[model samples]
Target: MSKKEKFEELLKRLQEISEQLESEDLGLDKAVKLYEEGIKLSKLCHQKLEAAELKINELKSDVTAK
Candidate 1:
């Protein structure tokens, strides 16, 4: 899958988790599990953004050197 697709999928999952957490009927065990999963997903998204930013910077530098 493309980077864009992966990012979109992660974002969708995060939103779903957010909605699930907001529900008043959720059990503690399930809520805790969702929170943990959300945290991991958040970290993954952050890492992906950082990597993309670094790549963009490198490309810009290369262009400026030409």
Candidate 2:
């Protein structure tokens, strides 16, 4: 999948996990597992955003240099 699609999918999964985590019926073990997955996804999303930001900055710099 493309970067944007992967990011969106990760974000969607994070949202689903957030909703699941909010439920009162979730068991502790499962909640912990979901929380762990959420953390990983969150880091990935952060990395994607950072990479995009860097790319945008580089593009702007190139335009300014010309």
Candidate 3:
């Protein structure tokens, strides 16, 4: 998948995790596992955003250099 698609999928999963974590029906073990997964996904999303920001900055610099 493209970075954007991957990011979107991760974000959607994170939202689902959030909803699951909010539920009283969730067992403690499962909740902890979901929270861990969510943290990893959150880091990935941040990395993707940082990479995109860097790319945009590079493009802007190139345009100004011409």
TM-score of each: 0.72, 0.71, 0.71
Using lDDT, rank the candidates from best to worst: 1, 2, 3
lDDT, candidate 2, at 63: 62
Q: Check candidate 1 and list the clashing pairs.
A: none
| lDDT, each prediction | 0.86, 0.84, 0.82
How many residue pairs in model 1 have overlapping backbones? Answer: 0
lDDT of 3: 0.82
Candidate 1 yields a Cα-based lDDT of 0.86
Q: Which ranges of candidate 1 are over 4 A from the true structure?
A: 1-5, 53-66
lDDT of 1 by residue, 1-66 (tens): 326558889999999999999999999999999999999999989888777743333333556666
Alpha carbon lDDT at 53, candidate 1 = 47
What TM-score does candidate 2 get on C-alpha atoms?
A: 0.71
CA RMSD per model (angstroms) = 6.7, 6.7, 6.5
Query: Which tens-of-lDDT digit does each residue in 1-66 have in candidate 2?
Result: 226557778889999999999999999999999999999999988877776743333333556666
- Which parts of model 2 are misplaced by more than 4 Å? 1-5, 53-66
